[model samples]
Structures are given as structure tokens and as C-alpha cells.
Target chain A: MRETESAAEARPYHHGDLRRALIDAARRILETKGPAALSLRAVAREAGVSPAAPYHHFKDKGELLDAVADEGWRILNEAMKAAGENAPSPRAAMPSLGVAYVCFAREHPALYRVMYKRSRDKEALPEHLHEGEDSAYCRTRDTLIAAGADPSDPVGLELATIAAWCAAHGLAEIGGFQQFAHLKEALGGEEAFFRGVFEHMGVFARGLND
Target chain B: MRETESAAEARPYHHGDLRRALIDAARRILETKGPAALSLRAVAREAGVSPAAPYHHFKDKGELLDAVADEGWRILNEAMKAAGENAPSPRAAMPSLGVAYVCFAREHPALYRVMYKRSRDKEALPEHLHEGEDSAYCRTRDTLIAAGADPSDPVGLELATIAAWCAAHGLAEIGGFQQFAHLKEALGGEEAFFRGVFEHMGVFARGLND
Candidate 1:
């Protein structure tokens, strides 16, 4: 089996694959051994390449970590979009978007923490905050707009988006408390509790009776 | 001024005052030099005491940090109480409770981070989460109950409490972003912006039209 796959495996060290390979290796190290174990040399080792090989792609550990964080954002954005799209309606998508956001943070705690901690110093909204059509903020904003949130009042729309984002983020921050274990179970486990809270918050979600 | 205050300053080295003095010094160091610069030795120097003085109260840097964090919790609780009490109505107090929560995080970010980071490992709710009538959680819970949230449905009340807490925590997490400067100004300022978001989330706060 090893002999048959060797040819395909050898492609990892190729110029185009090395960066992606290194990032993938870094991600594994991040989840398995935690952030402290990550370094260019270690990533190179994990990628099964020569120690100097990572230098061709990432100039230093910071660059490699940045690449890893970028990957986290991409995946997180996709998760939010998928969760939103799976919802029955645009009105319901708001909570789904929040639930997915918190789920992403819970699933990849180290990567999630590192991702935002880096952006925090920038004193501006990170890329996920309404920068483009695919950005998480815009997705949330679009959902709210579809749900009959006022599109004309740009400031009102932004505050409403912040309200929803902050609710998800705040839940992620302390959602793991054992005190909530009973409530979470009672509410039909974590996702239900999240959707419940999101619905209860209901920035534009006026149809709880429905 | 020094000649008059020397006698009062002399009180800080007293047994009870020494511990408080050390925490105050640590707080100053935390804000000025950041967490990396903290050590029992550094705190002793900041407190203007013998290098060995901190040992009498705190056995290690960790103990000293725990003490500092305790002081932070006390201050945060007081802020929440004041905010809740100041609100004109029980319904409005929910947002007020959240506003003060975020304000505390903003005013003393380093201490606030240290406080919660230590609690994160416990996998349980922190002391402020409905442990007593004085705790922040109960204050929010009591406010909600006063405002018509069902006390008999303890689970419902608990979920509502969490929603409000997370909103505040999440805002504090990213409330410093410069992107909100214009909105903050348009809302009449930062506190107003916080109130708006909190009202928008409104957990059990359905009277947004009010």
C-alpha cells in the first residue's frame, strides 16, 4: 500500500504544494500538539520535508502561523455560510449564522483564539466583518436585510449585525459552563440551546410564535 | 504634600494594607507594563517594599496574580451592581447590567483578561454567575424576573441570563474596534452604542419599541 501511494505523496514537496502542505501540517500540529509546538522547522518536519524547505514558502514562524490563521478564517466563513444557507428562511438564518460562528470557535479553540488575537491589535474590524460579499458580516447583513431589516438605515443595519455577532461571540466565550449543562441538555443539547438563545435575542427574528 | 501624607503613606506597609498595596501595585504594573512584566519581585518593587515582603502574603507569582484577579472581580461586581441599580426600570436594567460589564472590561482589559483566563480552566461558571444575590448573574436574573420573565421556569430564566451575559462579554471582546467609532458617535457615544446593541439583543427585553 505504501509503495503504491509513494508517487502521489511525493508531490507534497513540489513548489506549489509545499505552501499548502506546510499549512496543512501546521494545522495538524495546532490541533494535536497545540500552538506552542508550531515552528517552521517543526512544520517542515510534519510536512515530511527538509528543515530548510519551509523557508521557501514561509519566511518565519509568524508567517506560517499567519497562514494557518488565514485558513481558520476561510473555514469559519464557509461554516457560517453553510449554516445560514441550511436555514429554512432568511429570518431564521441569523441564528444559524450565530450558531455556526460559535460552533467554529468551539471546534477549533486554539486556532480560533490565535486567529482573533492577532487581529485585535489592528484596532479595526477583522476581514470577517462585512468587508466583501463573502465576508461573514455581509452574509449576516444580507440575511437580516432579507428578513426585513431596514436596508436604508446603514447605521441601524450595522448595529443590528453587531448585536447578532456579539451574541454569538459572547456565547462562545462562556458557553461551556457546567451550570448550563442541564439547560443545554434540557434545550435538546448545545445546538438547540444556541438556536434558542439566538431566537430569543431575535434582532430581526420577530416570528418566534411561528 | 509629602510631609503631610507621609504618616498616611506609612499605613500601606501595615499587615492588612500590604496585601492590598501589592495588588494595587500589580494592577498599575499590569496596565503600564503588561502581563509579561509581572512577577512577585516586580510587584514588591512597585509596592516599595522589601523583595521578600510579598512572600508573607503570596507564596508565588501565581498567588499574587490570583489575589489581583480577586480584586478585579470585586470591582467588576460593584460596577454591575451600580449599573443595575441606576437603571430606571427592571427591563432597562438588563442592558444597563451589560453596559457596565463591557465598560469594566474596557477600563481594565489586562486585569479582566487575567480574571477570566484563570476561570476558563474550571469548566464551571465563575463566581459572578448567579452564585449569590450580589453576583452579576443574579442581578441580571432578578432584573429579568422583575420585568416579567418567569421565575418558576428556572431554566428559561437561566438561559435568558446567559444570553444577556454573552452579549456583554462578546461586545467587550471586540468593542474596541475603530470601525464602530462613527456609529458610537452617531449613537451619542460609546455607552449609547452599547445600550443600543443590548436593547437590540434584548434576551427577554421584548419592549424595544419603548
Candidate 2:
């Protein structure tokens, strides 16, 4: 970082800019070097602030990472909501959310890993994390209910929502991440894979009708 | 670990048993403390062997963890096979395998986490892991084929197998490992949860038939 002194010097953290600078730098480092590479000092340096500056906004690296993940979920919720809005029906909406999830995981592998894979330090996951989670679940749950699921019974609703989530999540982990990129195309590619699962799920939805 | 010194000292390494002793020690530590607690020195100490002794049997911690995971998969595969063995029909065996999977994960969370959660280090996984994976897949795939599904096409078989695996894994993670455990009795419990999912899936399957 010191090698690029001029770049650092040009970007001093102004009163209102330090926090945003730190978050942006953290995201860059997370993308280029992954969550393990994230450090408060590094973020502070990247933001052209004294090492002490990040402490003003984040208590520790975990808090910063948590904020990043929180932001990620928020971003993900928006993407899922947007995609679901375009679907012709609630059943059609389901695959779009599934695809959107896989797409987000693929696009933000590092953030996704920190958000879900690592045992999150609660310091990073604030109270708002639940709100983000609930919002995402609401998108899915509402789709199921609209498509004829009985939301009054939490049992079936939760089961189906979790099933779709795990399918998408496992597929993303097994395909979208670097570990299994080699198998992605063969795993019916992401689009076909999700469509196939959702199509199968549509078959399962018939039981609700019965 | 030091608390068990007397027991450790009583059972010396090469009493026609060192390998099994080390394996047992690894499992014990893993069960109590999860994978991060696994250490060659610790296992050696627990087994009453010199620190260097484990290298003679397992190259490193990843190798040791892989071995433990393999062992877990072997047990899981056997349990799954046993579930299939006495089931009434091929279709019955499929959900039985799902039940066995959930039961195994709930019964041995640590072992299940080690088996699936840990990033598979290729240098450590060897053919045994793949063999175990194939064994589990074939157990379900063959059953699906016996139930009159086409197995000659790889894509169809992969989809069904993965879908089934995802359902079982999702159920276990949500029903056993997640906060849903607290809601189990009130939420109609694991049996009802699985029944609802599979029943819906059965409806979906019939849709494919139509």
C-alpha cells in the first residue's frame, strides 16, 4: 500500500467520507483478496486515513465485515425482489429469485462467503440482519402463498421456503464458487439447473393443490 | 485432555492398536470441539504417542480430517443402505435415505459438518471421498431407476439425485441445526415436516407424469 503513496495521498478521508471510503476499500479488498485479507489497518490505509480512523466507525474487523455482509444481504434482497416482480406468476417468481440468488453468489463470492459460510461474529451482523433475512423470506413466502400455499400453517410454508433456499444455496456453492466452477457447465449450467429444480418444485406444488 | 492422562498412559500406542487409537482420539476431539480443535499434537497426546507418530499414519491435519470425514460418509452410506435394504419399494427407499440423512446429521452434527462443510482439500480428499460420494449417489440413483425413471441420461439422474440430496440436507440444516429446532414441536415436528415436503414432491412428480 505504501508503494502507491500518491494514490493514498490523493484520497484523504474527509469528515463525511471516511466511513464510505472504508466500506468501498473493504469491498475492493474483499473482491480482490477475499475476507481473510480484510483488516482494519488495511482498510484505513486504503481510505488514506490514519489507522485509528476506522476504529471511529468500526469497533473491529468483524464489525466491518458484518457491515459488508449486511450490505450484501440488502443488495441481494433488492435483486431478488426486483427479479420476482417481473415474473408472470408467483410460481414463475420462484425461479427468478433462485436465479437471482445464484447470480449474486457468483458475482460476490467473497462477500457471499463472509456473509454465510464463515461463522459470523455477531459484532459484524447487526440487528438489521434479521430484517434483511425476513424481507428476503417474505418475498419467497408471499410467492408460495400466492401460488396456493396456506401461509396459516407455518409448517409447510417454512419447509418449502427453506427447500428452495437450500437448493439455490447449495447450487451456488457447488457451482458459482471457484471450488466447483469446473462442474458448473456440466451441472446443467446455472440457468438450466435452477429452471430444472424450480420446474420439479412446480411439480411438487401440485400436492398443495390436492 | 490432560484430565485423561492416566487413561492415556494406560493404553500405550503400539499395543496392537495405535492406528485405531489415533482415529478414536481424532473423533473424540472433533465431537467435543469441532474441526478447528483437531491437531496432530493434540491427537498424539490423547493417544499417548509421540507428536511425530501421527505423521507416520496421517500426513497432516487436513488429511486427518479427511479421513474422519470419509469415515463419517462410510457410516452415513451404510446407514442409508440399511434404510434401503428393508424398505417396501424403490420409491420408499428414496425417502428412507432422506430420513437417514437427517437422522445422521441430527445425531452427529460435528461429524456431518466435517464431512460436508469443510472445504474439500483435493490433496487430502483422495479417491475415497469420491468413492463414498458415488456410493451415496448410486444408492439413490439406482433406486430412482428401479422406480422406473430413466438413468441412462446423466442429466436426469443428476437432477433427481441432487434434488433429493438438497431436500434432505436442507431439512436437516433447518430442522436440526437452525433455530427451527426450538419450533419443532409447535411446528408439527420433523416427521410432519418431511411428510409435507415429500408429499408435495410426490405431487410434483405426478405432474411430470401427466
Candidate 3:
């Protein structure tokens, strides 16, 4: 970034709003054109700012994308939180949150793809996503605990959290298949289809014949 | 296709072996150079075959990618089938298949991504993938029935199958999360980590405090 330090000093002011505007520009581009067309220069152009403006807020396109994905995760975390709060009971929060997650993905397909695909090559999910209280993963864990998973059993707890997260993630990806269209219609609609998947999110534990 | 009808006819012979070779070449390319580097011409070059020879089998890169994805799905289905068969009991096959699904994704991350991303623009999972006797999705349905989900209850059966599929899919996507590194180490090795996630694939029916 120091390579452009003279340009940065020319601005001589904080860019709190510029940072937000640049992210918004990247998102609009993601929605309209897709990820391939997104670049720092494009984002700057979209925000109606000078060519070097985006660099002031983000070192490069990767950093800018990370910010966009951070925004996406925040939105998802909020939705999951709301789902947990709105459920009829602590137990019900499990599937409600799952439903919320799938809905979030369906609503923001581009953002959803970016959020997950952001770290496709990274050794792990971006730390900010799973770390801290704002994390959507943490919300899942909280709901799992409220739903009776033992907090003391770290292995079981993490496994269960991964289970819930995966179920929701899987449905979000493949639940829209034509094979499931009839089932979705029979279940009443999109949300019902989500519920159907989640209600049975667990194995049939009893395995009737057993 | 008529545009190249004469060219295709120029080689009036069965390409059974050539088709297989082309697909093999594609796999090698995918593994070595990643998806962006995969093209029909590249496959031909890799196979040490003439560029036009690939044309006899694949009209374009998209068509070849579909074939590649088909191979991927077939491998996945077979793995799931093997897992189901190897499990001690039909009831155990449910999670066994889930474990197999994730294992397949882990082993073939590039193929796995191609398999799903192939239909990112389409209305559904590829028709052949979900349609025939060999489909991985069908395998999931069969495992659900074997585990005692009611065949008569179409909604319930499909829901169960979807839940299992999504859980596996989800884990395959996020299961390696660095957040779970310690948990994976504690659980044993990677396969054990897969099992831990699968073992708790279902929701906690009892809600301990209940």
C-alpha cells in the first residue's frame, strides 16, 4: 500500500463511508455481473470515486472481497439469531435456524456463494466468520446448547454443531433440485420444504423395525 | 451439432476406447492444472492424441466437463454403495453412506467442485445424475428406505433422504474447517472426524433436559 502512499496522503481524511461504499459497489457488481467481473478498479468506478480510492479502503481485490464476505456473514448471523429467537421453543430453534440459513442463501445466491467460496483454497474458514460472538457458527452452537447438546462434551458439541451446519448447508445447495420440486410442492412451499428437511434432520433414531 | 456433422462423420468408427481415454486425459488435467486449465484441446494434448480426436468425442469444453462430472458422481455413488454394503446392518448404513460421501469429496476436491458447480446455472442437478439406477441421490433414497423411513410416506422418505444428503454435503463443504482442527485431532484421524460428524447426523431427539 505504501507504493501508493502519496496518493493516500492526497486524500488526507478517514474513509469510513468510502469503505462502506466500496463494499456496496462490490456487492452491486456481484449481483449484476458476477464475481469474475469484480475488481478493485471496477468497485471504485461503481462507487463513483477516483481510480485509487478503493485501495485506500482495501489493499487489493482479495481484501475488498473479504470485507464483502464479512458483510454477508454478518447478515447470515443476524438471520440465524432472529430464527432462534422466533422459534416456539429452544428445541424448535434447531430447525428454525436451519430454515433461516437456507432461506438466506436462496435470497442472496451471489453473496452466499461468495461467503463460502471465499476460502475455497484457504486451510480453514476465514477466522472472523467462526470466531467472536457475531459469528453465525457461534449462534449455531448456542442454539445447539439450548437444544440440549452437552456443552462440556466438546467433541460431541462440535460434531453436533457441524452436523446442523452441514444439513443446512447441504439443503441450501441441493434442496432446489427438480427431483425435490414435487416434494417441495407437496410440503406446501419453499419454507415447508425446508422444514421437512430439517424436521427429519436427525436420523430416524428408532429405526422403526429396530 | 450439424455444423460439425461432416467432421464428426469423418471418423466413422466406434470411439469407446477413445472416449474413455479422453475422459482420463480430462481427469489428469483437472488434477494437475485445475478446472480453468481444462479444455478439450488440453485433454487431447495431455493424452498425446490429435486435437480433432477429442472433437470426435466431445463437441466442446462444457460437454467434456459434463462427462467429467458424471464420472465424479458415479464414483461418489459407488463409494456410498460400498459404505452401505460394508456396514454391519441396514440401520448403520445411513451414517456410513454419509461418511462415504464426505470422504469422496475430501479425496477429490476438484472433481467434487466440478460436479456441483456444473449445475450452478441449471435448474436442477444434472438429469442423468438424479435419474438413473446409478445415481448417488437414488442411493441416498435407498439407504433411507433401508433404515426404516416409510416408503409409503413420500414426503417423509424424501425429507429423510434429503436430510442425509444435505448433512453429508454440508460436512464435505465445511467439515475441514480449522475451527474443528483440535476436535479432529482429539477424535483420532480424519476418517474418525468424518464418523463423528455422521454419528450425530440426526437431531437430538430426547433433548436431555426434557
Candidate 4:
């Protein structure tokens, strides 16, 4: 009996581990085939498990996708936090965080798309992740407040935050498109192009402070 | 012979009009089902034509999509131009153009998504629409140059253009997502929310000028 239990544990199918395995498989599918191609059966096939195995963990594809998006937000929040922590000051952290935001989108285009699927139904999002309180959003807002924006003026603060957020998000989405290939080539390479954008972001950030 | 030709034209199967019909059908499908759900057969079915009919007009789905995206850009350029032309001055035109951009995306989410599909291959885009010379992109650049950015400094002009573009693009993309529904509600409604964003863009534009 002891040998059989140890064998089951060593087989990588131990109880409660299937959920994590499914999410990992889903991320792989999302990264490679994109959200449109993702399905529970595909994830199960990628995980080398029976289709019924995923059903045991997720109620349906939406539940599984919600889990994937949840994980994506968590990963993004960590990346933004790390970028802020590594920067020299709150002022510098602003653009660094913006760079990190765009870089995250570039690295995980499919996952990022899935994370922001356009359903127009807020219920589709996981309950714990409120957009206003999202770690990254709050971090950006706090940075703006620290940089001399009037914290008491809610509208002013909101507008400042939106300006910064919009600029970063726009760069990420547009930069991801192929239409800018010529501009990227002219700027030397992708990294060089992003560097130029980041430098401009520094100016935009200072503008916000003023 | 004249009567027969008139009859054929009235039948909605006019020889030269199939391409236009197919494109119109594709737009209906795109607006209803979105880009992910778009397919050649579905477009043909929507047009009440045989499955093979679309092939006569478009070799493949990519060709059809390119056509749809091309139409999207032409419409978007016109919208931006109208917004700029109606504004009182170049500075006023900046935020008007930004508002028009976000409003365009909100009004045509699916078409906008198809127009900016994330293909890293430059060949995917139509050759005529050069990124640097794209009407909307160039218009934004010219507006920035007109707003006091030194035209002599190419890099400065480029960065300023990018900052403005990124902010507008970000607002459009982010506003399309449901996560910001609460923010929209808090600001009163969609128009009110957009008004707030446009107001912020005005401030950011002044910052750029400074």
C-alpha cells in the first residue's frame, strides 16, 4: 500500500495537482495558438490527460479561461512591482513601469489578449481583480500622487492616471502590430524602438508632474 | 440584351458587384460575430451566395481580411480628418482627433480589431498604407510639429508623435474592454467618460507644447 501511494505521487497525477497542470497547459495553448484556438479538450490533450480530467477541475471553458486571465494579472502585477522596486525613485519608476507594461504585453501577446477579452460583461472577470484596485493601476496612481499631483482632487488624479495608462497601453498595442515594421527597422531594431518610446515617456511623465 | 443586363444587375448578382457585395457581407459578419468568427464560407453564406463565390473575389481568408482592414483604415482616416478640420485650431484639433479615435473604436470594436490585427509580418498589411505616411499617423505627426515641437529635430518630432498616438490608442483599446465599465459608469456614461478623457488629453497636449 505504501509503495502504491508513493508510485502515484511520483507519477505526477497526485490529487489536487491536476488543476495546476491544466492551467499550465492552457497558458501554453494561449501563448502558441491564441485565445481563439484555446479549448478545454486542447488543454487536456496538451497536458497528456483525458478530456474528463479537465472537467473534474473546471466547470467549463469560461471557468478555465477566467483562471488563465487571473494568473495573467497576477504575473503582470508582479512584473510592474518589480519594475517599480528596481527604479531609482518614484519619478523614474513611472516610465520604468510603463516600459515593463508594454514589454509584458509583447512577451505575452496571446495571454494579454485573453486577459482583456471584449465581452462588455464585467462578470466575466475574476471577482478578486478590481480594475481600480488592480495592483498596477494603483501603483501608477500612487506614483502620480507622489510626484506632486493634488491627491485631494479626485478628477485631476484620475485624469493624470488615465493619461499615463493610455500612453503605455497604446504603445504596447500599436507596437505589437506589423504596420510599424518600417519604423522599427529605421530605429535599428525592436529594442531600440522601445528605448526611443521610453525616452519620450520620460518627457510625458515629467509633463504630468508639471 | 439591355433588359437582360438590367435583370442581372437587379438580381444582386451583377458580375462586377460581387466583390462589393462580399465586402459588405463581411462587414456585417464582422460587426456581429467579430474577427475570430469571420470565415470565407460564413461571409458567402451571409451574402446568400455559394461557398465558392468568395473565392472568385478573394483567394483566401487573409485576402478577404486585408480588404476589410483596408476599408477600415480609409474610413478611420476620413473620420480623423473631419474631426481635425472641424476644430478651431491645430491645438484644438489634437484632442478632437484623439476623441474621434477612441469614439471610432467604441463604435466599431470588431472592425477596429480586424483593422489592427496583430501580425508581426509586414507583408500582411497592404503595401499602399505606409506606416510613416499613413494619413492618420502623418496627421498626428504634423499636428505635433504644428503645436511647437521643433520640426528640425526629427527624433523629437517622432517621439512627440508617438506619445500622442500611444495615448489615443491606449484609451481606445482599454476603453473597449469591460474592465473599465465601472469607470465609465462613475463618470456618468460613455459620453461623459470620453469627455473626461478628452479633457485630460488637452492637458497632456499642453504639456507636450511646453
Top candidate by lDDT: 3
**Per-residue lDDT of model 2, residues A28-133, tens digit only:** 9899887667878888877777888888888777677767777888898888888888877655665677778878987887788777644322212234433543
TM, every model: 0.80, 0.76, 0.83, 0.82
Candidate 3 CAPRI assessment class: acceptable
TM-score of chain B of each: 0.79, 0.76, 0.79, 0.80
Global Cα RMSD, each model? 6.5, 5.7, 6.6, 5.0
What stretches of model 4 exceed 4 Å from their correct place? A1-16, A32-37, A118-134, A178-192, A201-210, B1-16, B33-37, B118-134, B177-189, B201-210
How much of the true A–B contact set does each candidate keep?
0.45, 0.13, 0.61, 0.37
Which has the higher lDDT value, candidate number 1 or candidate number 3? 3
Clashing pairs in 3: A202-B202, A202-B203, A203-B202
Candidate 1 Cα outliers beyond 4 Å, as residue runs: A1-22, A35-63, A202-210, B1-22, B39-63, B202-210
CAPRI-style quality class for the chain A–B interface of candidate 1: acceptable
Return the top candidate by DockQ: 3
| 1 versus 2: better lDDT goes to | 1
Worst 10 residues of 2 chain B by lDDT: B120-129
Chain A accuracy as TM-score for every candidate: 0.78, 0.77, 0.80, 0.78
Predicted structure 1: lDDT: 0.74
lDDT per residue for candidate 1 within B1-210, as digits (tens), equals 335555555644355678888989999999998765877889889988888998888887767787788888889999999988888876566666777899999888889877765566455545555688888778777877776666797766677677767777888977888878888889898888877776555322231111
Worst lDDT 10-window in candidate 2 chain A? A118-127
